[model samples]
Target: MKKTVLPTMLSFYAPDLREQIEALPEGTALIGISASGQAIAVDLDAEAPHVLVCTSSGGGSTTVLRSLTAQFLHQGAHALVLDPKRISHLWAKGLPTATHRGNVAGIHDALVGLGEELARRLDLADSELDAAPRLIVSVDSALAALRQLTRYWETFRSKDDPHTSPAVAALEAALWTGRAARVHVILDGTPAPGVLGAAPHELFGTVILARVTASTWQRLAPFTGPAPKPSRHSSRGHVIQQGESHETQAIWMTDADVVTWLTDPDDPQS
Candidate 1:
């Protein structure tokens, strides 16, 4: 009997995030690098519209997300970032494409507004669909935000509030019906059962796991086979979608990169 060893990070000739973004065609989702150094790009319009990134703190999740956000903005998409900690998304604060940014309270309002916008788009006929801009709602530390929202709800539950929890309702609405209206969500955090409703799998089309414990992986994706154990020293991660899994590297992005991306070439001060 031989002991089974899971795959770890291996050397590959993958290009960095900037190169991949430059090479990909407009409107394609840059899904990072495969173990064999292949660039994974998906057409969101034709495929799944939402992504959930699961990882512990300092697990390179933010790097992956910022890379995706930059690519989205470069390709003419509007972004709304929810950063309860107010640190993860500071780089996007003044960007022209960043329509919204702040703590959980702001997130709640933004989602509600987005829901209304989604409704407006849904009401439009097919000929008017081209006027809609692709919307990306990026939530950093989603689990933390959900926990905070829960705490707030508990504090106010005794008052007999008439309206539904705005945060949860907006999130649920986006998860349920925003796909067809060109609205997509990107959540980066640990996956906790019952936090994002009974069945989170139905809400997200793709899941990315990075430097997480085996137990956590199993809990989130029990149907999949053994999760790949990437080397802690490397920037590798894994993506699961449609019953398939692939080893990948969450591309790294820096504050300088973000600043460069957001700065307008024509305006020296931008």
Candidate 2:
């Protein structure tokens, strides 16, 4: 069905998809398949909040997120992502981007630097964050580098009380939603307890889930349920999924295929 019985709340987490989808707040809408790079929300229904989840391993580095973010930016949000190599630079397309590489000294500088750039992008002079999704991409070397500073490393924070885990907690606070640009964290599954794939909250807009299957695709909502509703014409039948695959296999979840909110009862558009 093009539109669900009600407004849909989506969640996607696997190799445990079925378990997560069963326990949303009730009547939550989620969509996912073993295949698909990113999930998206494209509704003009201004009365309520709508989100799309697109999670995967490297989908963070691909155009999937860049384009999705560009759409949000166009919608007047300050889109943000934390890319390690500053690769998000290519996606900037001339939008002003202030970057911070965690210097060898202390990551405190990097965080402060990011906070300043965020202040500029969000248009706050004294660096007070407003309650809107302003896009901000804070590309850093690694969470470990920032947190586990060695004597040879430059990111030692006086805040590092050996007893307290400041770096881990600080990173978590920064990435939560309902704050700035609906933050997205990019990690190559190497940070151990703090990888993006196994995070605490799945409130992110989209995550490049994983590619464990044949030429794997991105998973939209891993923490939430992914309701793989067939296309409108085939909700009762089977519809072939189309698209090309490479570096990041590209696919389309058209308005006809995914569940949506009702703003257009006559036709489907994306």
Question: Who wins the lDDT comparison?
Answer: 1
> lDDT of each model, Cα atoms only?
0.69, 0.33
**Candidate 2: segments with Cα more than 4 A from true spot:** 1-39, 42-60, 79-81, 86-88, 97-108, 113-133, 138-155, 158-169, 177-206, 213-270
Instruction: Estimate TM-scores for all models.
Output: 0.83, 0.40
Model 1: lDDT of residue 162: 40
What is the TM-score of candidate 1? Answer: 0.83
Tens digits of per-residue lDDT for model 2 on 12-120? 2123433433332221222333223332222212221223223233433233334333344434455334444444334342353323333433344454444555445
lDDT of 1 at 257: 62
Candidate 2 lDDT (Cα, 0 to 1): 0.33
User: Which structure among the candidates has the greatest TM-score?
Assistant: 1
Clashes of each: 0, 34
lDDT value, residue 268 of candidate 2? 28
In model 1, the clashing pairs are: none
